[model samples]
Target chain A: MTFRSTLAALALAAGFAAPALALDAGTYKVGFVTDNTGPLAFAGTSFTRGAELAAEQISGGGYMAVGAKIELVQKEGAGDAARSIQSYNQLIADRNVIATACCILSPIAGAIKPIALNNKVPLVIYGATAPGLPSLPFVYSVTGLPGPAEVAMSKHIAEVAKPKTVAYFVLSDNEAFQGRFKASQAAMEAAGAKTLGVVSVLSADTDFTAAATQAIALKPDLMMVYTTQSPAAGIIAAVRARGWAGLMSANDAISPLAVFKKIGPPLAGVPFPVNFSADASETPKAKGFIEAYTAKFGAAPDLYSAQGYTAIWLIAQGLKSLPGKPSREALATALNKITELEHDVYGGLPMTNGQAGTRYTLFLNWTPDGKIAAWKP
Target chain B: MDLFLAQLLNGCALGALYGLFGIGFGLVFATMGILNAAQGAYASWAAIIAMYAIELAGLPFPLAALAGIAAGGAVAVLVDQLGFEPLRRFGPGNHQAAMLGALITSIAFWIMLDSAAGLMTGQQSLAFPPGSYPATVFQIGPLLLPAMQAVSLLALAVVGGGMHWLNTRTRFGAAMRAVGWDPVAAALGGVNSRVIVVATAGLAGGISGLAGILAGISTANISAGLGQGLMLKGFAAVVVGGYDDIRGTAIAGLLLGVLEVFCAQYLSSSWRDAFAYALLLGFLMLRPRGLFGGGGFTRA
Candidate 1:
């Protein structure tokens, strides 16, 4: 025989003798829809990075079996309703991703969720805190809704500030935040705080002079502000600029370090809730994942990253334990079986009411020197 | 009583800032018979540039403010050259067509400027540097006054008084008024109409920039879209006070600001804009000639 024909014969024999694991190797495609390049760009990118890391770990035989790999499809939603729905459809219809994961803003979730439900695609949601959404079937939230977090935060603030009277300076246009304002107010009132008054302003309002002045006039001991980081910073500065000595409290909307950077010293001493902290987490896998993520991404994981990483790992676990080549429905069933998960970055997270239960939020105060420390309740 | 007095002072300070910005809108409309839709964009750009100067370059606040004003003036000159001037040179034959063309061009410039500033901070507003304004409060009898409010009011008075002088006193002021009344007639009477137009635009833009800085100092936050709200209120002031009446525009602006504040204080802050706009709509319906119209400031 010729040398080339002899080599071909040997390769054929070797292929027949190879392990069956090679033949069983397959890829599960997952789509990620998020506001990656828009207003929520930093958050969306962090979520994407975390998911990517989890996919890498799982497919590379570190977190799961070696033969199966996960292929991630990413799309930018820009947090727009129409755009998010379009991106979801394109990912499902065109890319044929078996499942999808998204993060950050609740408005995007509200927009694309109906589409996911009708199409019977298993959609995983993260970070969106608008309440009344945990009941949706086929739509799983890795992070709990805003109701529990705000309630917890309000109770915490009442304990820390000990204010007799609290006023709300809310951005009326943010539907989610606005919707929670009443519940949060009730929570505070129930916690032995008096409701001073509620001052509402448009989201585009740069000058909060009138609103702040009006609120300050009421002599409230604490101000509960609901707005994005940019405007929240403005409102805080405006309130302080008016020489009001009252304490201020806000929700997680104003919690990111980037927000503190924008707000500078004004944000110091202000308490807000955070969903996760790598340094403070006690989950065994969380420490290892944090080190691995930092080693891979060259930055410590934030709340979004932690949640995103957990979300992908959750999906991977479902895919791994499934009996055979998993269909979308089967994968979703496998995911439903995991009532609680030991997260790599956030310790233990339990699922309830068809979604992750409300996790305990950590309250932190920014120090004068730009460091964050846990608040003593 | 203290609360009421404090709210009153707040309204007045807000009014002064509104008037300062209103002057820019009033100037462009009075001179060219075109709505300067980009007026707010100029204010937004000024705030961004001022923040960059103070934060990144570490310039003193006052110097940074001056730099911002200069940038606003430069942009104003560019807008006049690129937008209004072009429309006038190669405009449609009809007056309505020319006005429409100018409006569209001005709005386009506004969007471009707003988008550019938004890109600088990834669509997030930046806080003014600490000490951009005096955070301390000054007590005057029963009223506790914020130092920034006092400073802003004083600055507005000085600028408004200077604007009044420039419009009614100097030979150049007379020339501008004459041109505003009738460009062809002023040209025939030996007035350099082009110089008047360019000078008016720059002066208006500088005033808008100063308003922007003062607003930023007051709120301690400067968003890229700051100018939009200001522009809306300023336009409303111009329409309510009579387009060419500069003093009337200032007074109207102050009135609107005070009214809005009172609405927020007594009614709902959410309804403040609705009430203010409703009042404007009422004025337009009841008296199209405006509160101070027919004074010949813009009479052809």
Candidate 2:
């Protein structure tokens, strides 16, 4: 068989790992559109694992109706705007798919939102944190941007640095990162800091030295970086290499341990807010998630996986709430009615019109050893 | 002035990487007469292997990197034998059709490599151990170069110089030129054109492997599709520098890298990508044969 066929076979087998053996419960078919191939593959892969874990939990824990099995139909989004729509359409058109959780990139979610609305297939956004993604009638967001947490992070940094000026390094094309910059900036300015300047690069940009030099040239007392993990690692190294080390913070995109391994001990004590942390808290569900995720994936769950797990968990819970056999419209109504829920990933999160308000406990600091712990300061 | 100097040094450092990355693409195009679309995948494979060696086997920096580079060459050879050779032999009747067939095969191989990398990496980015390489700062008057950048610059010099020597002064270079020009005639003359093509592919893969590892260490752009941006930037350099001219490609890569930095710093960082694209378009219109022009494809 060709490599393509082999991969397709593997995907088909993996997606259908849970056999529908539920005696009396109607099989609830849900769809997951993933960007599992390109630069954003990290999120897609992790999110899928999270969804798998949750799907297993729903079956074993009887989170759904008795003998009610949840079938996850996954389509490859390929992490592009055009491809996401095609994938979403495939999910919506066939197989009685009640709802679809899609995308780790916000831009893609935005692109597919209109299509989902037109099809009236409830779209549960797994991880697109772009700011101001309007939660429409049929659309819901599980992963909100780190804006609120960035504000909290700014407050935390203010307690330590109290910088009077701030400079920004951002992924200019990424609305999510830009939202983070804006939030961090607002909080800093509220603390009496002035904007120094902003230097930007595209999301795919690798060379951060030039942008870093320009940002540091402004000599801001504090530097706030808001980009994905790869750029976050590069910019951190670049800025530190140039000795702009008054105080630095970044969003949770850099929370991955692999990224910390590259940036090295330079990441020590850098504060960032995220939506999920494997740092076991007083919350039992979170502790269970950490253990389960680590046991299955061999690594602690990060933000993307948490978003994926929560997306599924939310969908399952919504499906469970309905009295009769689950339908698409009922599932949509069930999802919207759930304004809040206690989740393992984020403390209190469900879908809303704008930001799905979540627990800010993921405000994190990097341990020198490239692992993360809940920030004390 | 100090900041300008710093940016200049940084630009040079980045350009060195870009040049090293692009030169491999130029080498494959020059020797094989086809774009190795899988060039990025080979880079990624090498990087993942290197990272695995470091993280799992506890190999030190240089040894682990060498292992990855060598693996890259081996993988390239395998692809050449399995993917490209079949296309050349049984694909199509015409030259253009065969070339296109080979290109499509490379792309298929690229996807295949990406899937393999995705599986190996668990679709997560891996990095060298934090202290695997020291981040020492080397200062020159007003300029500062970090250890990573310094090492990459050094690599570019050796690579660019070595490729130049190999292309102009070696028997292997002659074989490669002969093979690239007319494989049938070269075979008639006992040049062992197949061996030349395979060796050239191996060398190209090794260079891209170096580029991948360097990128991982310096920028941490290490992932399944990590080489996509490199492929784009490298292809741009190749197009602007003349596809067959390695030295010209390297120089063009550096120039593009510096121009990107200057535009981002002095002008608008938001539209910096557009500026580089505009430069690429201008080069295409003004100097279609590239800066060095051409002495045909074989004169590399």
Candidate 3:
């Protein structure tokens, strides 16, 4: 044989020698739909990475129960709702993916939820935190929703700080943040704290001198801010610049330590609650997860990263439970039945209420030095 | 009341940046008789370039600003040569068509630049360290003002003064006005209208770059959408101030900024944007000619 023909034949032989990881004849494919680009691309990248890693590790170690290889298909949602739905439809129709994972944006998740239900495909949402998802037989959230974070934060504030009065500053432009803030405010009021007043700020407003001045004049014991990093940082800087010494707290939207650092030392003692953290050693799983994530991603994983990693692990766990070659119905039932599953990466979270929601969250507060540690409620 | 005044001042500071941006838009409109929609993209490029220099290259802040200004000027000149000049030879009625082309080209350029930036550096807001400039608050009986706002206002003054000097005191300025008034006449009179046009675009771009750098420093963060929203608001300011009236454009920019702040303070923050557009719509309907109306130029 000619040298070229020999090389080609050798390549073919090598390809054939590799394991075929396709699903069984009767099994459908599993599609991982996510945003690989746009505003929330970072979250999507981590989610895809986590899922891909889990699939590879599990398959390599012979973790599948049915001795059938699973096929993983990935699609980019581009962080647009219409495009997400279109991508979902394409994945469902073409790939026949039995299960799917979705994006971080609540609106996009909400839009895709209906499509997943209609197609009867088990949908796993990893990043979205918007509350009040309608009951769908196939849709399940393995990560903590934004509601619990707010609830936990309010309870912590009322129990620990015991502030006489609280002022709420919410970003009125963003509907999701606004809704979460309002709900948290109601919870705080129910806990017997007097609500000073709610102030609305535009997301586009960078300079918060006026808002800070007004907020200080109210003389509330604590200021609860609900906004994203950019605007929230601006508000914190403005308030800190004016030397308003009242206890400052923010929701998950403003939880990143980088934000506090950017706003400078005035935000030293500011408290905020987050769902996950690299230094939350209250749980034994924190150190190991942090080490493994840092080793893999070259940095300590943030809350988003942890949630993303846990999400794929949850999916893999559910996929492992199927008796025979897993089908769409089998995978869905397996996922729905997951309870108190140990996410080796994230300590242990119970997936309660299969299609409705999940109750799993951890409260973390930022210290003066920017380290986020679990606060014992 | 003190809070209201403080917010208004804060708004004015932001408005000054917008005004500088509007001046750049007005300069292009006055000289070329075509609205350059790419003004914002150029500004964003300037900001991104500055950010890249400061964050990635680890250059000092002033050096980064200089690099940004140079890049902005280069981009403006490039757009004029490649995107605008070929279409400039079209008839005066093609002015609208030329603008549409520039708008589409600018939008495309924005997307390309934004994507390229994102791919090169992972997508996240590039936040600068605060206290890069002093955060000293100047208090006047509860109406507190940031020292940075003072710097912003000062920058606006410099831009205004520089533009005035360029337009009135310099021979090149006279030549520019001559070309703007009648390009055919100026070319016939040996004015080199093409050179004037390119120079105008470059100068306007440099000013826009300065605005972007200032904005990046002031806000402490730079992102892909930096220029998109600013472009619309700047255009509105140009329209309100009168496309040909440079001074009016600057004033209108500050006015819009203060108006947005007041609206954010009293009305819901969500309505602040609506209020800005509403003001623009009201102004457009009431005075179609703009605040300073008179068309003195047409592109040849």
What is the lDDT for A289 in model 1? 76
The digit string of per-residue lDDT tens for model 2 on A164-228 reads 88888888887667767887788888888899898887777777878888887888888888787
Docking class of 1: medium
Question: Which pairs of residues collide in candidate 2?
Answer: none
Q: Which 10-residue window in model 3 chain A sums to the lowest lDDT?
A: A19-28
- In model 1, which regions exceed 4 Å deviation? A1-33, A36-77, A86-93, A101-107, A134-137, A157-162, A171-175, A278-335, A341-344, B295-300
Q: Model 2's CAPRI class?
A: acceptable
Tell me which residue pairs clash in candidate 1. Answer: A129-A146, A286-A344
Candidates 1 and 2: which is better by DockQ?
1
Off by over 4 Å in 3: A1-30, A66-72, A203-210, A257-267, A281-286, A355-362, A374-377, B56-58, B89-93, B296-300
Highest lDDT: give the candidate number: 2
lDDT of 3 at B127: 49
lDDT of 3 by residue, A1-377 (tens): 99999999999987765333333333335677777676666456666666655555555545554444445688878778888888788888864576787777778888988888777788878777666553445777766666666777787878888887998888877787888787888888888888987778876665576677678768898888887656777777777777677788876545554555555566566666655666663466666667766677676666666665666666667766664456666777778777766554455576667532334455666666666666532
How do all the candidates rank in terms of TM-score, highest first?
2, 3, 1
Q: What is the lDDT of candidate 3?
A: 0.72
Number of backbone clashes in candidate 1: 2
Q: For residues B132-245, could you state the per-residue lDDT of candidate 3 as single tens digits?
A: 545687878877667777877887888877886887799987888788787889999899999999999998898888777777666655666566667888888887887777
